[model samples]
Target: MSTPQPPTHQQAAPAPNWQAAPGTSYVSPIPITRTHLGHALASEWTKIKSVRSTMWTLGVFLLLVVGVGLLVAVNTTTEDYTEVPYTIPAFFGLILGQICLITLGVLVVSSEYGTGMIRTTFTASPQRYRVLTAKLIIFFVVAFAVSAFAIGLVGLFTSSLHDGESGTPWGRSVLMGALYVSLLGVLALAVGSMLRHSAGAITTMLGVVLVPAILPAFLMLSDSMRTIGEKMMEYNAPNALARIFELDTDSGTGGSQLALLAGVTAAAIAGAYALLEKRDV
Candidate 1:
């Protein structure tokens, strides 16, 4: 029969400290606002733009594409072609441009791995697929910007030079060219990711992209070798891309051929992503 007395404020005891030591720093929690993917995209964009290779590759593609078109157009004379009034600047430069484009793609991913930055990239963006998509988005945008410049210049200059025959449709040609270049870069990105070594990726891509063209030339020296060379050139990426650019040409193949080539490259890219997931960071 008695009411409990109110406890005094001074009676409460202090809780024991659980931290390792007085001088030790506490681990910080991940921020709620952290946008790892956004950070990765921005960093990737900066890295892509900052590299000397990117600048050189873009500059060279611009010159080879626009400059060559201008040169060919200026050099065209009345005697050049009577049957075809307008000339599509010989696409020989595309051959070289592909190499540059592929290099740009390869460097996008391989350079990171080469410099031991892949670990950091993976750590920052653990969602591997998101990282791949981010790189693709950034690379494609850059490719489009540069491709527009090159293809637009080609169309503009070619229109000026030719007097008689109908010229290529600027809109279609430009769009196709941009898509082709962007896809080539994407293909290179896949190769780079799988190989993770610049030399190996570059060499392999060169073989996949260029050997087809060269084989036909080198093998032509011998009659028996001609068939071998011709077969190799049949499914080449450059040839398939050329089909996309000039729809009128026989293209030695059809839309399905292009789809097949793209499909193979896409499969390769998917395989690279799978490897990325399985392998150590």
Candidate 2:
């Protein structure tokens, strides 16, 4: 009979309060801090160091720059350098080595796009410009440092081998040469950022670096184009590098070359920033 009478529904006890106690706040175990450029720089440094391409490209670069430079020095007599700076030998190697830097620069940005890692990168760092800036800074520093070291090493070797051959401005030439090559890498990075394709960006940069130099030769064949060809020879990357090392004395100062390249690089970087901001990951 008691079963027949449905048990009265007991009032459900009030759910226990799950909110934080009054005047108390839950603290996350993870530290919360606003990220800045330093964090971005660290991330970029880690990335640049960790990649296999970075190692391979830079290794080849050092090998070409130092190896060829030393080889050239070993083959030459002191008289060979009397008319040119001891550091001029480094120029021969750097002509080939610059390609490595350019390739590395393109890979710095475009590889991420090819591998779909750029999405993750953009997700983690929503401030795209900061990420680009970090890449630029890291790449430039590494490229410049390695370039300077290789060129400097070669210069030291040549100077020791041919001491007192001439009172060349080796120090200034080394600095300017390194700056020129590093700026080329920076420009490649800007192109990479804009193109977002490793092969295409790399190819485009190769054209940028090589085409002008080569086109001038063809243009020189034409009488009317000879002036334009001469202009190209003056401003092209190889000639600029040559001038920076004081190898081309007939031309004007290398300062103009640096300024021109700097302006072009600045413009490309501006374009890269604009596209990065406007485009989707």
Candidate 3:
């Protein structure tokens, strides 16, 4: 038999098959999009309001600002410009409230990291820019609102204390203060997002913002130190923030410096988002 012609060899393979398991069905993943910003904003707003710190900080911020204004108005030896010269009280109280805003900003980004919920956040909003943008929008809105309350309370209280004195230009002051507070919160959020370490971000912000202002005052050399202080004043945190006041305190030292700081801060926030987008959360 022709050696039984060598049989042509062919591979045997498992049959193609498909079946659904009992009580099981295919589920598709939800598509993420920019429109998801609304959901993100709602979620963030819920998270912010649910926190105890938010309540405490708002209360304390209002109390300190209003209390200090009352003190300054009541004790003023001369009602120089009426309005009880609440600048000292308002300014210092604002500085204190800023620390709280920093903490709030940190929580905006870090709380998710702390709880391992950032993964979910990223999942729900895979387009990282949307998530960050949503966060910033929410922060700006919330910060502006809270700052208004604090500033308003101070103005109201100060106005009450000054019976014979004219009202301060608080309407403008409050508006400007609100803007400053919003910017400060944004700065904190950007730094916190970039660093991802609560302690490190907070410490760095405080050190950079507060320590430099103090250093200028301590130097022994008067003229040179004054020059250094003046130059450094151009970089000081308060000046950058003081822009909201709108009162022309000094040209080079206050608004100009803060305007520069705001510009730099906006750039930093953008850079931070870029890094956050490129890195693993």
Candidate 4:
């Protein structure tokens, strides 16, 4: 009668488990931890190693580097101490094997886009930039370590095989060259991220690495052009690596090429990061 007050039939909300997180207050049976870069790293590592492309590419690369390195060491019977460093043989294998590294680099990012897995990657980690950073870091570390190992093994073999011809700081030489190659791989990853297509990214990177070297060979028509060609030949990634290994005919360039490559790669990666933010999956 007092306006027929509705029955005070009320039920209290269930108490939340203090141990669980906000979103999982009722869903989770156990506690959950916030994700960090370490979690991203683990995810990236799992993705990288689980792919067949990684295994095949790295396997072929190892075969080329070690086999050719050992063969070169076994065949060099004379020591031209004044003309060559014994560690130079490693560069030959690296030159031929680098395509594999570039391929792996492109595949690392572009393959996700190619297969439409990038959506899941982004969905899992909404911070697109963080995912990219993780991929770049994982790719760079794997590349540098593998390249250093191959070069070091070859350098030691060459050092023992042609001890008299070896120059001082062979380890430094090996490491520098490995660093250059790894940088190139990172550049490839940037290209992959920007292009977002496996074949396209791989092809573009191949051109980046190979075209400057190849173009120089065709531009021998005039002195001015030939000079340009010579500069390109001297400054390309492969040539920079050769110089790092002390294989270049002239050491005039020092490490300026590597520094240049690094700068260019940084710019490319920055651009890629911006593009990732602007573009839709």
Predicted model with the maximum TM-score: 2
**Every candidate's lDDT:** 0.72, 0.91, 0.70, 0.84
**Candidate 4: regions farther than 4 A off:** 1-32, 81-84, 162-165
Q: Rank the candidates by lDDT, best first.
A: 2, 4, 1, 3
Residue pairs with clashing backbones, model 4 = none
lDDT (0-100) at residue 147 of candidate 3? Answer: 84
User: How much RMSD separates candidate 1 from the native structure?
Assistant: 7.4
TM-score-wise, the better of 3 and 4 is 4
Model 1 misplaced stretches (Cα beyond 4 Å): 1-30, 34-36, 77-87, 163-168, 216-231, 245-248, 252-254
lDDT of 3 at 145: 90
- Model 3 has an lDDT value of 0.70
Per-residue lDDT for 44-130 in model 1, tens only?
A: 898888889899988898778777767777877644544222324535456577678888898888888888998887786788877
Displacement of residue 8 (Cα, Å) in model 2 is 26
Stretches of candidate 2 off by over 4 Å are 1-29
Q: Candidate 3's residue-wise lDDT over 58-127, tens digit each?
A: 6776666666656655665335444323443476578677777777787788777777888998887787
lDDT of 2 by residue, 1-281 (tens): 35577678899998654555345696444555677899989999999999999999999999999999999888888877766788888999999999999999999999999999999988888999999999999999999999999999999998898765565768888888889889999999999999999989999999999999989999999999999998998899888888888777788649999999999999999999999999887
Query: What TM-score does model 3 achieve against the real structure?
Result: 0.77
Q: What is the lDDT for 170 in model 2?
A: 83
Q: Please give the lDDT score at residue 175 for candidate 4.
A: 71
Writing each residue's lDDT as its tens digit, candidate 4 over 1-281 gives: 35776779789999777564676546675656777888899999999999999999989988988889888788776555445556667777888888998899999999999889999989979999999999999999999999989988887777676545443567676677777888888999999999998889989989998899889988877777998898888888777877777666476434888898899899989989999999999
Residue pairs whose backbone atoms clash in candidate 2: none
